[model samples]
Target: MKGFKFAGIHAGIKKNDQKDLGLIYCEKPSVAAALFTRNKVIAAPVILGKEKIKIGVCRAVLANSGNANCFTGNQGIEDARACSKMVADCLDIEEDHVLVSSTGVIGANLPMDKFKTGVPDVVQQLSEDNVDQFADAILTTDTCRKIVNRSATIDNKKFSIMGIAKGSGMIRPDMATMLAYICTDIHISADDLNKCLSAANEKSFNRITVDGDTSTNDTLMAMASGTSEAQINDAGSKKIFQDMLDDVCFELAKMVVKDGEGATKLAQIIIKGAQTKKDAFKAAEAIAHSNLVKTAIYGEDPNWGRITAAVGRSGAHVVPEKIDLYFDDQALVLKGDWQGTEAEKKTSQIMKNSEITITLDLNLGQETDSFLFCDFSENYVKINADYRS
Candidate 1:
């Protein structure tokens, strides 16, 4: 809340001459936690952030776009280290007290000269009013800025959490879909902060998909400044802060789905009455990632066969005769039997909306899970194919 400074600057690393650098500074050592992509081929910044966060307290974060610094092996690691060290030197903090993140073309080397010129300017421009710039500077294909904030009270104390994220492609569950940075003034231990962040990611960032591709540079960072002086060690305060944080992250996650590159519709796929939570996820993800299903949604075609086929192959122990399906509020299938043409017409209308909800009830057990996804479009293919050009 107080004494927080953030800055964003154009570092000339991107080919388009966009602002590709950002930094966040907290006056005091803040409790810090981070989650990186589960992809085995990780980026350079992820490797460095993982080690820096082990110190349990962080005073600054440095991020860059346009080059992922991945696939270069040992050189990538050295670049990450050197960048963080540069930021530390400018801020007069320990090298381990600063974290770094990068997103862009994978397997390319970073231009260290960009860091030499940008880190010092970032340090000089740090201010409380530039949080939005930091949020916008980290984007790749994002169409608009994504940010969400919330405030809550536990006992007589109040706290606030604000988060910014960017992801329009290369999104899948394994961890965060893309980059997310969350900051709060709540007082919580680094251990507790990590715990809450993991729990929240499971139900939020980990449950979304776009193109079913996981990135090598996904990173989620949360910093708790303890500025509110409200100790979250107690159960009540912990619950309040965790709920607030989860809500903020969930909002950002949904925003990612809605902004999926060239996406025409945002979809909520719910699989219910499965034998287990894992089964539900299997069914949901299978449908969400299917090119046929996504293309159908894009065309506004209520094709039930594609949906059923996805469920059958999901390995969810689905019994075709016992399943029920709905597109939005339109019931297309009853007890696995297709309704008449009238119902099909109504469901087609439902699929045409900007936001659509599809439900599949297995009629097996009470277990249920949902995944958020976006419809595939021609623009998505064009954007990725010509990304570098």
Candidate 2:
């Protein structure tokens, strides 16, 4: 967390009068890596960020909510660049060193006047303790902050990693959802940092789904300040750092799913014994993304049939009679056979919890994969129905 200062301020971008602008300033030009949305129609900030991150260095990050600078064509890119330049001017840093991101209502223009004045104001308010404000500023429908911190000892030296993210809808795999920024005090190479981030993201952000819809403004990035002498060079040091990074990303990813728009319960979908990792992912994601299964979860119904049906159409290699299913530890189906009324009763009780795990065994091979999802509810429909209003 050293060398990183944060700030968030109300910039009039959001009509509701909440803090809509966030900034993170690193004292030094830190090594950086990033990932952006795979959506064909990318956002303006994402387009600029994809280029800026290629410099493999960053000094500041400017983000805003309530206006996704997307589909504005050339004007959006110009606006994003103009905002980046504004922040760079205030911080006395290169415009290229300031990576930008925007979220919330898409296909609309950013309130340039807000950035015209808010830029200098937020820069003036920068503080090392304003992470909470920054976290709050980036949230849309998220009910709370998705921030996580972890520490590791590398080469007898201690290092810290902090992650912050905001995503409550338009969530699915590929490049994942919304925006995430990671800061670490450990020394690392750009290549290694990218590797760690991509690997960790695969098992975390890329493994979660809320509505099975990807966003146009998705971005994930990491910055290493090197203020701490702890470095990652060898395999052992890299592994330790990788583990901590995974923990931080996964925790944030789970928070996004749990705080999903109008979600009341979080579910873990596990698919095992597949012939390949692709097959495993297909099965797990299919179940997680299935509206029928999600609604069943929300209703606290032990409808094991919905889960099996999802897998059947998942395009994964599966044998009809070889499947087994369970809700938590309660087995509802054994070798594709109903375990009986007692099992359904037990599973129904389990589903009533705020969090539950659904496991399906393909009994095929060794591959396995899992996904985090939230139950589909009436409130979810209502929230999205009026999201723009």
Candidate 3:
């Protein structure tokens, strides 16, 4: 955090005059690791960033909203390169060391003229105090900025980790549904940092769903400035850094789910007592992505049948007779049978809360998994239907 500067500005990329461009610059080249969307139709920046991240070092990151710069053929790649080069030229750094990201409506070309005129001014406004602005500038439909900070000490040496993310819809977490940038002041190897990021992502971004759609420009990246001089070479120090990183990413991921487009309830689907962790995850993911389950939650209905149907079709190992289901602490189904209208009434009340948990016990083994998701509503449909208009 100490060696980084942030900036956000309205570069005319967005028609509403909102801040659409953001920058994060480190005083020196920092060790970097990144994860990108698994979707084959990726944005130009995602393609370029993946190649540049292979070197494990970066000096700055430039991100823009309001244009995904995808499906534009070779011109999209040229525009992405031009944007990165402009940032490199303004900051006197190598173009390869400057990474780029973009989000918003897909299949659009980037406005190079905006970058040609605004890059210098945006660079001039960079400061350590502008992190909030940078967070806001990366958003598309996100109602609020998601930022988190955590610290840890190892061997009497202190380190700081900070992250910012933006997501509201088109979130299914194939690799992070939206853009997130993390900065740390600890010294660590790029390989170690990558391992830490992947582990953290599995429990955080990879476990959340909103609309079940993976965007073309999903990315999550981390950089270590090594300004703290706290070396994380040994196993003990690495564990400490990884734990702190996981907490930050988890909190940001929760924020993304909480701010899901037109979502009023945040629900956690837990699948337990499975034959394998993979089976549990499969079942939980199915329940999380089911529109029927989501709408039932939105309407405060204890629709246990929809949940069971989703789990049964999930392809996970399951014994219908051994299943048990609960809404929060109230039982809706016991031993694979509906608990009657009285139990359904209680579960309905529980679903009325802003946050609720739906637990399913397979009664097969000890393996368990869970996913964070949100309720579906008519507003979600409206928001996406007219998003570009």
Kindly provide the TM-score of model 1 when superposed on the true structure, using C-alpha atoms.
Answer: 0.98
The sequence of per-residue lDDT tens digits that candidate 2 reaches over residues 71-147 is 99999999999999999999999998999999999889888998999999999999999999999999998889889
* Better candidate number, 1 or 3, judged by lDDT: 3
Candidate models: Cα lDDT each: 0.90, 0.94, 0.94
Q: For each candidate, C-alpha RMSD in Å?
A: 1.0, 0.7, 0.8
> Which runs in model 2 stand beyond 4 Å of their true positions?
none
TM-score, per-candidate, Cα-based: 0.98, 0.99, 0.99
**Which segments of candidate 3 are over 4 A away from where they belong?**
none
Pairs of colliding residues, candidate 3: none
Q: How displaced is residue 299 in candidate 2, in Å?
A: 0.3
What lDDT is obtained when candidate 2 is compared to the true structure? 0.94
Mind giving the per-residue lDDT tens digits that candidate 1 earns over 71-184? 978999998999889988998888888999898898789999988998998899899899888877888888888989898777777788998898989999989967998899
How would you encode candidate 3's per-residue C-alpha lDDT over 1-389 as one tens digit per residue?
Answer: 69999999999999898899999999999999999999999899999999999999999999999999999899999999999999999999999999999999888889888988878988999999999989988999999988998988888888999999999999996998689999999999999999999999999999999999999999999999999968897898999998999999999999999999999999999999999988999999999999999999999988899999999999999999999999989988888888898998888789889999999999999999999999999999999999999
